[model samples]
Target: MPKSLVNYRVRHAFLVSYLLIVCTAAVLGASQLQTDPGSITVRFIIFGVIALILMVVGAIMGAVSKKRSASDIGEWNYRKSLLSIREYEKVLGRHEEDFKVFYDDTSSAGGCCCTISAAYLLYLALGIIPEGGIDASFWFTPAATLFIIIGYALLGLTSYGIGQHSVTFGVGDFFVAPDYRGLKHAKMLEDEEALYVKSLVKIGTQDDLQALFETEWRVYLDGQPDTVYIQLKVDKAHIYDYPYLVGIIVNGPDVVERTENLDIDTRFPGIVEYMSDEGVSVLVSRFDIPSDSAELEHEPNITAQEFRKLAKALARRLIKLSTE
Candidate 1:
């Protein structure tokens, strides 16, 4: 079958299963109600309606929840919006603002409570509110309703928080900025926009890379915070010549270098190939290192292994400098 057909079938199956379970629970609750002499018809009707509404809403929310992207700016905006709503609620109570606090609170809670409440109510409607007694069933209804309300309220607040964090522009946001340094020179050659790649490079003679490694040991150290640094070099040869010298520098001074027996030349070819496959453009010479301060301004995405090696190198350098 086609991929789309498979996906449709999967979704259809899920929907059918969900509906079956819900209908079964409803039937069971109704049966229990029929047997119970003291059951109020009006109460069951009200609970059933509420439960149905919660389930529909919760399911819809759940389906859409994956589309929500969490970002720093979005989170900040949501918090601000929620706080504004809360402040308005405090000032006006139920009637103070055009936006209702109950609605706000409900949306903030998210879909979990709505789902749970609906399921609980469906069970109650089926009269399976658990035969432990009235006390057990009585608490269940209110608890389920409360959970639904709280869940939706959280969801609304979180959604709003995320919205607030998105990048906003008024007047000064520019698509292109002038490069005071030679950073933009690399991009100009390829007729492409500027893209940055960051990795640390060890400075010294060929033997310095090996010396740096011997000074640093590979061990999990505590009470030390992990730090990531992005280094830019104008020279590509510096990268090729050092082998895993950059990795050694980042690992820290105490890390032992095992370059003698290992082939660093071939191992990094895979990384280069991977980057090339990923469409990453490179434009740097052999060995010239860029200024640290200038490189620090631009954040570049680095691979996990690259980051670890760079971090270890920095730690080693820090240790050596401190001792000196």
Candidate 2:
């Protein structure tokens, strides 16, 4: 596992602050040189304008960083070997009660306070926050105070957002392994892991349990809050009526193939969406648990272990059908 999420947040705070200061200084100097280029009295006017733009841009980048990418994929696959689904499933089991032990829900707010405090100190050093009351003339005091308050708040919030993003980007490191034991049922997409993981859902059956012992369809999750998905590594176009077949198998032989693409029905059986990347077709299906949590839960009627058994069976059947 990687360092505690807090460590990443702390590092992110310092990194962001340092860059902000350096970039702001550089931009302010360039702007000054290009414009009046002389009197360096207060410079608060230029500093405020440059700082606002930089912080806004930084916040936007922080938001984008939350979206996962091929490069962000984790050390396990960062030139590392792949492990089977069974092995990962075993890892899942080991951490069943404490899987979150490796995760910190509060890490998102990490560095928020530090960022705010640092901003305060930075303002003091710049004479923006003087020992006496307002640092500016009577006419400019209100505007300056308001701008400073808003800017300071943005700094804190941006830091928090960035820390949260780091956690999102790096959380997968705690859940890495590669194999396709559960691919046929859904399609995988590039950067699909960018989607937040609300919870892990498994929906296999029992009779095909033994078959899973041999099949090789990789399993992964995607989508976000309120929607769960499974991604598999295969050219789904090769499979005829892929969505219809899965719906029938999981929903029942009575399931109908609609004139349009399949959808998650009132029962939430599952829906299939498709995409292709680099010639590899990927499928997205809705076999995910419908909750915003890391803990796994089944239909109120079934036990958790029973739910895993069902998921395994579903995987086996889907793989067998794909081979045929």
Instruction: Tell me the lDDT of candidate 1.
Output: 0.31
Q: Candidate 2: lDDT of 253?
A: 24
lDDT of 1 by residue, 209-263 (tens): 1100001112222233222122222222322212122211233233232222221
Cα lDDT of model 2 by residue, 102-167, tens digit: 343545454664664477446534534343643434323335434444554466356535544544
Return the TM-score for candidate 2, rounded to 2 decimals. 0.27
Cα lDDT for residue 3, model 1?
A: 26
Candidate No. with top TM-score: 2
Q: Alpha carbon lDDT of residue 246, candidate 1?
A: 23
Q: Which stretches of candidate 1 lie over 4 Å from their true place?
A: 1-37, 54-119, 122-130, 133-270, 273-324
